[model samples]
Target: MRRFRARHNASARPGRSALTSEVGWFVVIGVASTVGQALLYWVMRHWSPPVLANLASLLVVTVLNTEANRRLTFRGSPVRAVQAHLAAGGLFVLAYVITSGAVLLFRHYRPTASPAAETLVLAPAFALVTVVRFIVLRLVVFRRRNR
Candidate 1:
């Protein structure tokens, strides 16, 4: 019984380590993706409307983000490439709605808020979506399959 318990714990250690590593990679990739999207949104907003810019920037970054998560953060996933990306699309939609809604709501209230202020509104929205995104990616998109 003691040997069995030790063996089980030893095996479990790698699982825990893998989860930690996955989360770390997720954070790194997510931060990079968020910054890139914010910058893109800033640049696009100069030429396009806020909602259009937000939509375009998110569309661009989401592809990269999904690919990065699939390749780096969730490297151990047995899911196929196309399937992973397709699943991530749902997350992208969720993020877009949250972030764009926040920006629009801010604009609605302030009427003449600066771009920087609008960008600041995204901070909390991103934080909220990121938490939800991580949970979905971990549980649904990147879940390890028992072989």
Candidate 2:
């Protein structure tokens, strides 16, 4: 079994290893971003509209995500970090818009719903945005060849 494991490890492709590492890094960054966003959302809940709270959360998470992705995920050059971060931020905003629109559409269809019900409908919308962001970040912002 030990020999089999050793052979399996040795036979793994270089790109596969890097991809695995990238995924690990993504999870780490995602956790940190989630925590940051949650905290920001909690703090702003009473003071702002839900849409504004969401935007503030997005902004906070994006900054944390950019720094984490640059230093840990891609190990990108410092020179390119700012450009990559800006591009990622644009993508983040696009995702946010899409999610927000989806939530608004749902709310329009169910105008009498409770806030909890609206939040349930919005969860999948934000999830869609997250998946898109992950793909864009991996394929565009932090591609191995580009870095």
Candidate 3:
């Protein structure tokens, strides 16, 4: 564990690693962003298919989410933020897959899932992606020494 910390600088921020604090901040931002996405998905679910509505919500939120994590959670440069976004493209697709798959599965099984149900299903999916995002951002996107 000590060697791991030494190599990764895992505890750079006093007691806990900067990554740990950043993940706490990321959860804060993620909840807010998920709320926004849910509201948008609920609104757009009327006009679009549930999966498509989710994609639309993600489209609107991803940039904002990335930027917020970049500035607030990661404390990274704008240039590096852009690089993070580029790296995050795959993860975004992964998130979309998780979310859209959940919606699609509910609809397929229920065949008449409500908007509320769609939104409800998203809760778990978002939770899953949030962890993935944190790990990826910590190891790949904003490792402190990467600067």
Give the count of colliding residue pairs in each prediction.
0, 0, 1
Candidate 1 lDDT over 46-139, as tens digits, reads 8888889898988898889888888888886788889987987898889989999999999999989888788778767876787788899889
Off by over 4 Å in 1: 1-5
Reference-based lDDT, residue 50, model 2: 62
Candidate 3 residue runs with Cα over 4 Å from true position: 1-17, 76-79
Estimate candidate 1's alpha-carbon lDDT, on a 0 to 1 scale. Answer: 0.86
Per residue, candidate 2 scores C-alpha lDDT tens digits across 56-140 of 7777777777777778877744438778778877877885797568656876887665545545554566555666767887787
lDDT of 3 by residue, 1-147 (tens): 889879676445553755576878898989988888888998899889887899889877777888888888878434476697888788889999999998888888988788988888886787788789888877777776633
TM-score of each: 0.92, 0.72, 0.83
Clashing pairs in 2: none
Q: Select the stronger candidate by TM-score from 2 and 3.
A: 3
Q: Spell out the clash pairs found in candidate 1.
A: none
Instruction: Name the top lDDT candidate.
Output: 1
Ranking by TM-score: 1, 3, 2
Model 3 residue 105 lDDT? 88
Candidate 3, residue 18: how far the Cα is off, in Å: 2.4
| lDDT value, candidate 2, whole model | 0.69
Q: What's model 3's lDDT at 45?
A: 92
Best-fitting candidate, measured by TM-score?
Answer: 1
